[model samples]
Target: MLSNTIFNTIQKISFIKRTKFYNFCKEIIFPFIVTNISKLFKDDIDEKLIVMGAFGGGAFVDNSKYLFEFLNERSDYKLVWIAKLNHVAEVIRKKGYKVVSTYSLKAIKLLRSAKFIFMTHGHMDLLPIRFSPKTTKILTFHGTPIKRVDFNIKEAFMYNGWGDYFRLKLKNNQYIDYVLTHSGNKIEHDVLSKQLLISSKKILPLGYPRNDILLCKEKEFTEELKKKYNISEGIERIILYAPTFRSNLIVKFEISKQELNRLNKLLNELNSLFLIKGHMVSEKIDFNDQKSIKLLDKSADIQELLIISDLLITDYSSVQLDFLLTLKPVILFPYDYDEYYRTKGLNYDLEEIAGGPIVYTTEDLIDTIRNIDNIDYKFKEKRIMLRERFNKYVDDKSTERVLDFFNIKYRA
Candidate 1:
C-alpha cells in the first residue's frame, strides 16, 4: 500500500519530482503487488474467456466485432465482455450477451479467472498479470498501423504517453503473448517486432477478422444504410473521407470553405454523396448547410460506410489497407504531410505506396475526385501488388483461420 508520507512528499515537490515519484510507484511498487496477487489466485482461476476493446469503453468494433459475432452464439467457454460504460454494457446486454463494467467485482473475478484474454488495447487497469506463463493473451490490434506506434517515438514533444522514450522501450511487451499482424512480409514483420519488442514467432499473420465484413455481400445492410442516408439508386456513389487525428493539433484541415464548396459541387455533379468521418480526437465539424457534404456521426459504423463508398479519401490512415480489399479507388489528401511526418513518424511513405494520385492542394483533390471513374482503373495493378504484400489471405476466411488456429469451433 502507498504511504501517506509519499503523497505529502509528492505534493511538496516540483512537477518533475512528482512525476518521478509517480513513476517509481507505478513501474516499481504497483507491479510487484499485481504479480504476486496474480500468482496467488492462479490456481483458483477458471478456463474461461474475456474480450475487451479501447480500454473497455467502446462497442465491439474492429477485430472484436468478428470474434464476438462468432463467440456470442457458441456454448463452448464461459464468456464475459468488459465494458467501462453502462451504456456500452446495456448495448451488449440488449443482444443477450453477458457483460460487466471493467471495475465491477464480476470483472475483477473474471480477469483473474479467464484463461484466455483477448483485447484491442492493453489492459492497463489490470496490471502486472503476466501472459504466456499464466493467462494466454491475444492482441487483435484495433487497426492496421501505418504510423509509428507503440513505444516507437520519433520526437520527444510529440509523445504524450507514460515514461520517457528510453523507459517505454520494452514496457508495452509486458503481459502479452500473441500479437495479430496484418502484413505477410518478412521485412514488415521484423520492423513490427523491433517497434513493439515482440518476438516474430508470436506475431500471428491471421488477416484482420474486421475485414471479413468487407468481403461479406450484405446487400440488405447496404440498402438499409442507403435508405437511411437518402442515397437513391442510379446516384448511389458515396465518397468517404476519413482522416487520422494529429495529436494536439491546432489546425484541423488545410482546405478553405470555398474549396469544400467546390468539392461538394463536384460530388453533386457526379451523383455522389461526400461523407466526412472525423477521428475521435477531432473537434465537432458542421457541414450542415452543404447538402452534398455530410459529417458522419461519431458512432457510425465505418465498415458499413466503407461497404457503401465508391471512393475513399484519407491521409496516413491504415483504413486505406482495408479499402484495398474492395479494390476501390483511394485519393491521398496529405495536406499536412511534412508536419505530420516531423511530429509523428510514419511506418511507410504514403505518397510512394498510395497506389493512387497523391494530392497536396485542395484544387488537386477536386481534380482527383472529378476523374475518379478513370482513376479507379489506373491503380488496379498497383493495388493488387500492395494487397499481396500486406494481406496473407484476400478471402473472407480470415476469421475462420483465427478460430481454427485457437481451436475455437463455430456454433452448430
Candidate 2:
C-alpha cells in the first residue's frame, strides 16, 4: 500500500506526464486483480449489514455522519464505520459506535459482505478495492455542486486521454449504484448524473442527510457549540468564515496582521465571534491569541458549525448554499475570482447564484460584517429564492426519505 504522502504526490503529477506502466497499473491492472481476487472470496452479502465512511475514513462527518447517527439510534441494521486512522476509530468507539480500521481483515470482510456501502467521496472512504457485485454502493456526496466536478472538469487528473476517460466512466458506473442529491429539479439531477458519469436513473433526489441536523437541532447544536467553544459572555453573534478548497491555489487570509487585528477589533465591538473553518484540503490559517477570531478544528463538522452560526462568509463554496437554509446573511469574499475561475471552473455564474453581498477586498468584507444587519434584511428574499432553487425539502426528514427510498425498515 502506498503511503498517503506518496499517493498524493503521484496524484498531483499531471496524468499525461505519468508513465504508461503507472497508468496501466492504476487504471487497468489494479482493478482487474482486485475484482478477480474479490470474486474468489465468495462472501455472501448480509442483507442487514450497512458500512459507511467519509473524507477517506479520516473524519466522521458529512452525509455519512448524519445518516450513521440516524441508523445508529435504531436497532434494524448492523452499522460499521471505517476509520483509516486509529484515533478516529477510538473516538467513534468511545461513543459506543462500531468502528473498523480501513486496513483490517474484518473491514475487508465487511466490505465484501455488506448489503449497502455508503461513501461521501469515493473508494477512499473505505478500502479502495473492488467490492462484491451484490453490494449496493451509494454515494451521499458531501455538498451541492457549484464548482465543476469529476468528468465535467477538463483538467481533472483522472483523465490522461480518451481511453482513461472511458475507463474511469466504466469504473464509476460499475461501482456507484446510487447517488443522493438535494434538489428534486430534473436539471440539477441531470447535471449531477453527467458529472458523476452514471446513469440518470442512479441519481436519488432524496435530499441531503447532513441538512437534516441543520433543520432539526439548530437550537440544541447552537447551545452545545457555544458551551464547547467557551464563547465569551455577551457575544451576540457567531460568524462562520468557511472557504472551499482549491486544487491549483492556496486559500490564505490574504489580509496583513494589522488588518486582521483591525477586523478582530471590529468583531469585538459587534460582540461577535468569528470562526474560520477552511476546507479539509485547504491550507490552515492560524488565529491563536486573537480574542475575536477563532480558527476551528479542521475535523469539526461544517453542518454543526452552520447550525450554530448567525451569519456566514465564504467564496464559491457550496457552504453558502447550505447557509441559505438558515436565512441568515452570507457575504462572499471572492478575492481570487479570476484565478480560481481559470483553474477550477464554476458550474454557475457566481453573481447569478450569490444570495448576498459579494466582496472582493478585505476592506469590503469588514464593511459588510459591520453592516450585517442591513445585509441580512436586504438578502432575505434572495436567500429564499436560492434555497427554493437548490433544496427540494426543507424538513428534517431527509434521512427518513433516504431509508424509505431504499426500503430499509427502521424504528419510528
TM-scores for all candidates: the values are 0.83, 0.88
Taking the tens digit of each residue's C-alpha lDDT, what string does model 1 give over 1-412? 1332343455446464436556565554554554444445543556556544543344556677567766777647767777655566677788888776654445556677777677765554233443335567787876656787742332321332443432332254656788887778887788777766678888899888878878878789778877776677777678898887566522265668898888888878888888887765345666777788777765566777888898899988888888888888899898888877887778788865796789888898899889877777878899998888888888887878887888776665
Clashing pairs in 2: none
Worst 10 residues of 2 by lDDT: 151-160
Whole-model Cα lDDT per candidate? 0.70, 0.79
List candidate 2 segments past 4 Å from native. 1-33, 151-170, 217-221, 248-250, 281-284
Best by TM-score: 2
> Could you tell me the TM-score of candidate 2?
0.88
Backbone collisions counted per model:
0, 0
